[model samples]
Target chain A: MKTIKKVALTALAAAGFGAVPGLFGLPGSLLAPGFAATPGSAMAQECGTITLGAALSLTGKYSTNGLHTKNGYEFAIRKIKEAGGVKVGGKCYNFKVIYYDDESTPARGAQLAERLINQDKVQYMLGPYSSGLTKAIAPVTEKYKIPMVEAEGASRSLFNKGYKYLFAVLSTSEQYLASAVTLAAEVAEKRQGKKPSDVRIALVVENDPFSLDIRAGVKEDAAKYGMKIVIDDRMPRDLSDVSATLTKVKALKPDVLIASGHSKGAATLTRQVGEMKIDVPMIAITHCESADIIGKFGKTAEGFLCSTQWAETLSYKDPLFGSAADFNREFKAAYDMYKNRSVPYQAAQAAAAIYVFKDAFERAGSLDKEKVRDALAATDLMTFYGPIKFSPAGNNIAKPMVLRQVQNGQYNVVAPSKFASHKLIWPRKVQ
Target chain B: MFGLCDFFAQTCGNLSILFAAPVFNVQLLIDGVLVGAVFALSAYGLALVWGVMNVKNLAQGDFVMVGGYLTWWLTQTFGVSPWVLLAGLVASFALLWGLGWLLYRLVIAKVIDRDLFTSLLATFGIAIVIAQVLNLIFGSDTQSVDPGYESLTLLGGAVTVAPQKLFAFLLAALLAAVVITFMKRSRMGQAIRATAQDPRAARVLGIDTDRVYAFTYSLNAAICGAAGALIVMIWVIQPFYGITYSIRAFVIVTAAGFGNLPGVIASGLGLGIFEQFGGFVLGAEFQQAIVVGVLVFVLLIRQIQQAMNRQVVQ
Candidate 1:
């Protein structure tokens, strides 16, 4: 008891150092994780090849997405190497992919992206499979003026800042969940055989910028169609049993439910709805595209129509179909061996951005940062998965979200009259 | 009606409305209870070291993390399920036990008669070094080894069990019970109890008190290791995950007074339920903050209570 008493008192002194004051700021950003690997310091060993930096997670909570983005990046790397690498005015720059493990920490990722650009001084950079990390390192890329073609980050604010350095291949934030909102609205609109005078909608989102953006975009679009957002409050990611939030949601009794969050969070909310037996027709934010919910919760994720810039299988029938087929094939081959969740969006686009960078540099006829930035900003090329284009603000809003639903426990592209590669299924009956 | 009244007061809404759907709140409470059991079981080890070992093991959390990764690797590499992995967990804990013994005998044993500041620094260093190594070996991936057991819903609401987590809860309780029973019933346990009460006297009585100390230290570590393995079955496991778990264990262990396993278990369940309520009412970002805050608050109260009790006795 005396020993325990003495030890218990230690917390008082240590409480002074435990002050976590605004960890979101740039100062905490610089208090870097010490495990960072030196690039040109040692990586110069493998010389005579053009170096590009990739800081991606292959493991961690975000590993599912990280691994997928790594695959996408690797896929592009393979394609780049096979084509004799980047062609700057027909002179091939044999690019060496300098990959590092960021481990999904925001501060660590910011420090690492800084190291990659400043130390090794790689002319170009790629990756990061999480929006949290991407937000951390976005300033670093902008500071250096290195045009990073983003394959996976979906924090719509990345473009809101008018940073020309970062270009994303993924969809805008949860607020811009065009496919999900449009699908829910159109189906209900058509079901009523006319546009309803009052389309009551409720917004349930995770407390993250990614989810916030999707929620915002959904509201923006809803207002455009004269729909009212009934409920808008951000819940925590770990708040799994959504009964309290959903009860409020059910009471508001919105005509449509626009749920936005990470895949696991999305799975929890969707599954809880099933468990609680709530029967409001729903649409998922972008995270609905991943295979975790379909795999873990199985069919509970079915009928959750979602808005995504990419899907796993596209019919190749639609002219504007996001490259879900190409992504699905390459992702399965690279993944599947690791018994983890399905591919995350961050992994997919971060990988594709490498090829986009290659194409941009080749088109510019120079490796100059300004020229490549211009080349990337002026990009109008079709990628393996989607028709690649970035707005002046560095967002590829051109690739409108392709709505999808879980049919028989698989992602099926279902909506947008032109991109309707498959028919939309509803009311998934749990056996 | 009071549940509703309390709900409305806390939620600042109609308690009747929140209480009408007890499904969500109850489910969160159950999950919390199970999770808290795991936290309490692990925390008892830290409490034991603080109580009997007289040296706070800051590395207790890292041990949980290491033990979790070890179980993950064991299952992934050697085809061991959580049930079958009990033997392996015991062996691994025994290794931790040996390490803790070596650490205690070599370093901490000397510092036992010294100031609290030095022990704190030494243990903190041990924690950082262990955490760094695990980060390197594991490459910082979040892994859930859930064997995809169907979720069981009670009262037909959002409370769910992956079946694996339910088992982990039982494991935590059972292990905690065994430890409690051993302390209460065993001869060595009495000696441990005796030494904890009056170490100088126990030594004078031919207890070979150092051996007793070393044995208790190892036993505590082995228990912690088992708790770590059980945690990974329910939640995602990462290298640094132990740090959070460690803090959680410390919180519950300290709040419970470390004298009773049931108390520790109750406190752990209390924390889980508190966190679940926080998630429900406050928001998720505040979940960790709430846990840490409650822990700090409870510990402060306990320390003050102990200080007051000591002054009164004097």
Candidate 2:
């Protein structure tokens, strides 16, 4: 009886292990095809395939945005294929991305980058999900002299390192909420009849590379105006609560509150600030669209100033994806989950990175790494995302970060006068 | 390090703010006590299992997450009315109890008689599996349920308390009371206490110790599930957020000692208040650091007390 029980338990454990992956809704057979050699079946792939490697955060803390990044890459690849593939040196080649789950860790990202370069022999590379992971993989790719087009890593620190082969499609993090600071100073002077120096700022950001860079930018801008920083707090990584910080905000009565911690931060701030009825005049945060804050928290998310790299309302257009609104419509049609939700800028910028690669491959006219590197460095084109022009430091300098406010459940551009489609709502009323 | 110096300077600055106003202390204390009530609920469950079954279940936090997700998903899929959500909380308790029983039969039952390390490893594996399954089902998003209740403002709006949080705290206190009453008055509870005292002796007395062990673990899981349900309504829940709760449970149980119910409750609330004050003073970045630091401090104090006792014996 004891032996039989032991055998039964072992068999049950094996069955559980086998059924676990199936629970993720990804069949083992489907995953097998992604690892196997490309079958020469499609007419568009008559010439060959250009396999690009990416280490994404398919699990762990950043998995939500990681999935968004992966979908964006897949959507762009499908569109490119439907557009008759990329013609390089008078031959057609379909784009294929070899992906590895970085598990949202820096060490794993670096190791996977090495594996993709050495073991998979993938010459061209795509970026990871977060700034931390991208920071990890960039050094490996740079050491191998592999040209990479990344959409996510936005920390100014990433560009300052002078990586020659690295190219980014998104605006740097320093520009993320700097506009909010300027707007805060303007409101203080115009409405409150106070000098910029009298403006009180409270900053609560996640203690990560991305959000910290945002904090630095806000501080620098605030310092220029001689604004007082009343309560500066760094939110813990697994941020679930911020009542303590909000309590301080109430006590200090800061005129402006700036926060950046990706989606979770946005959600927490919106929910708790509304629940606690924190009566700050202005509140700005990152990742409002990615978090779907207006959809989740409804009226509480109203009057929130969100920073974005791209908005579908913009007039940017291209030959392949057409106008920004067209790309938005087509992407929603492709991904069912995004049907009722606003497509995040993370996905738009990710797709733009792929567009950059396609343009560079065509412009270079050769598969040689050096030629591709120079072509990427000289990238100057317009897509549905924005203009792609690389500075000497490999960061996109052509695009401007726009500030959008959640007005009546719609994200309308409200800042930088050149892009303001809606007026700023002062003294946000919590109902 | 410059960072350390900056931290100290910030902490001092925060301390001065506290002294200058003193009204903010009420806000911090109220927030801490409310948060601590939920922590105490889970810690009580951990204590019950550790004392009764001799098994250290590291998956306590994951159990809470499961409960929270169950409540959140139910509300999302069905209705968000107050009555419906209250039903969801009860359903979470019942469902988690069943899950606990299944886990006991499949994993915990076998490891119950093994060494301490064996149970710890088994539960750790269970934690990973539970967290992963939750991630797959929930898509790794942080979810919460809004109770749509108003907050009470006090001290000229310097301190505001959400009614949902107060409701959660009351529910937690009520549940703890009911569980304590059952443990003291019920026949099964006596058998479980007997088993905890001495399993071999209880077996000799025909107490059906296995049944007692199973019952104790399931009850603990049920308590944790209820706590999770409350947490979802009050704060937030995510798949990976389980480990933090697990760590908190371990800290509370360790500081309270085994089988000490009152000690668990007090220590849980104390830890909550300490975390709030610490986060407020040191900045919120050091909240988790403060938790682990307290664990170390508590252990060190216990060690010194034990050493002094040994010297007295000599």
Candidate 3:
């Protein structure tokens, strides 16, 4: 009984010591004061900066483009700060971007988006790399009512849903290949003196939602022009080999070949085109904008036209970057010095997304969520990434898809006449 | 369809378009055989490691990736000619063999004496580390080496074959043959076999089982490295491609079973042919599905067979 009493007293003393930190809030409150405060109500007012949170795919299959998107965000932030940031309610508020690596998975992307909103206390949000990731993150941002301006994630299905807070700067996936068919028709008429109906197309798409959307656009546009589809093949899931499809393509000898796949698929087609010697008049493949295609194929990459969201040679001008040319020159100089890289269309779109947010924030004239959202909805400004205007469904309807061809080992904008930096090169004069 | 007819005409190259009908799918078959040859090389390496070490090296493809990157780096850094592929193969093999030794000493040695589950989990961890490390070293980009080989028409133009692929096939076959001879005749091979059959008995008979294990792993890595060098010469490779290689190797070995050399070779070729034909007929979207499907089917059949054999014993 005497020993039991002593043990009970020791236990009580330990419990009292443990409760002291909980009751008095010793170092916890002092160490992390921001942890107890709300995001919009306290943090935004205290910092004098508008923090935009992003869950980017920094270390997975999408990491290549993810890093590009991150660089775009970084560049845009630097530019915004240089221009005295966005004006909100007579206050000059600087912009800051906080990012978490989502590892290219949709579930993890959603989780990180939530953490960024609730824990990191970001008022605004940026969309992730691919459409799948955006779809995952959109609902979380919507639930929290934080406005998200995204540059990538071009899936049309993402806009079909009625989500007000989420907006994308890049054109929808359907627009990707819609212009490819149009270009093929134009080339057939100009070069071969053939009618639009005379254009024969062979489509090889990657079996993913994004590529499937590209296929749908091609089909729809082909029907509009009455162009014939010779052979339609979906590249395997691994994107390992396309010999079988190429073998079929070799026989058909279609007037034009429109292929949409991942970066690897583009490289495979480029290599196989030379190896199998499939001679099509015009070869337009998506993902040529990727550094991998030219980096892998080198001179062999020449002559193929690629569907792109943005091209540096485009004549789009803005207050921040001066012109597309100026932006490219500045970006290349800075990015190459830091990471030895060239900026792609994805990076351009990412920076353009930030510009949209800056434009909206200043127009809203207040940091209020609904007001900023209204301003984003009313966005009708033109920048380096063409005219920025969002449809009621929050899809960017103004930016026209551009087709760029690799000529003399450099990407030149070739299609949508207004954006054309050069004449279309048909049949890729193979040496 | 006219397109189907055109396929035969184009495959038969310059043959009269009217004579397009043939009972055999010569084009797909040829493609399959060429692909099978590459798979066979990696399959042999996987089989050797799994049979002797009882450790499924999930990082098999990463080894192949490292080998490819090594060759690419050499070519890019030194402007090595395409013809130096033979020398590249030797260099890759030696370097990867050293890597194998290090892997065995650092990680594989820990799991060698553990349960199969432990080895699997540990190797999987190794695979993730290797993949991430490679990604960090070489950014996520698909790279390839040009061998400057043209396609050669075979069997009266019925089959179009890349000379580079044919070269890789021949080299793979020669290496497999040499390894087979080594296993059959070498004293070390006998010791390895003894250790695999009865580790305790082999140790009692004055055999150092640990040394055999290290040599076996290094040999596997060497084979994988040579195969990787061949792959870069013929096919495109990325940092993340190691998982696909691992999957292919696992499927081939499971289908062939442990310690069955001829079975491993035959099954690897069979899988390659099957995948090519399946991709063509069922559509390329189902190519990966076909590999996993075959693996699942084989496992089901084996399980049923095992249950039936157990009933007989009872």
lDDT of each: 0.67, 0.88, 0.81
Q: Extract clashing residue pairs from model 2.
A: none
Candidate 3: list runs displaced more than 4 Å: A1-47, A193-195, A337-342, B1-24, B153-159, B292-314
Question: On lDDT, who's better, 1 or 3?
Answer: 3
> What is candidate 3's lDDT per residue for B54-169, written digit by digit as tens?
88888888888888888887777776575577778888899999999999999999889899889888888877887788788887877888765667776665456777788888
lDDT of 3 by residue, A238-295 (tens): 6567876776666567888889887778878888777766678788888875635666
What is the DockQ of the complex in model 1?
0.10
Candidate 2's residue-wise lDDT over B193-304, tens digit each?
Answer: 8888999999999999888888888988888899889988887788888887888898899988887788889989988898888888877888888887888898899999
lDDT by residue (A146-184, candidate 1, tens digit) is: 777777677777777878788887667753565566666
lDDT of 2 by residue, A66-141 (tens): 9889999999999999998888889877789999999889999999999998767788999999889889999999
* Best candidate (score: TM-score): 2
Best by DockQ: 2
* Two-way DockQ contest, 2 vs 3, winner: 2
CA shift at A374, candidate 3, in angstroms? 1.3
Instruction: Tell me how much of the true interface, by contacts, candidate 3 captures.
Output: 0.37
Q: How high is the TM-score of chain A in each model?
A: 0.80, 0.87, 0.88
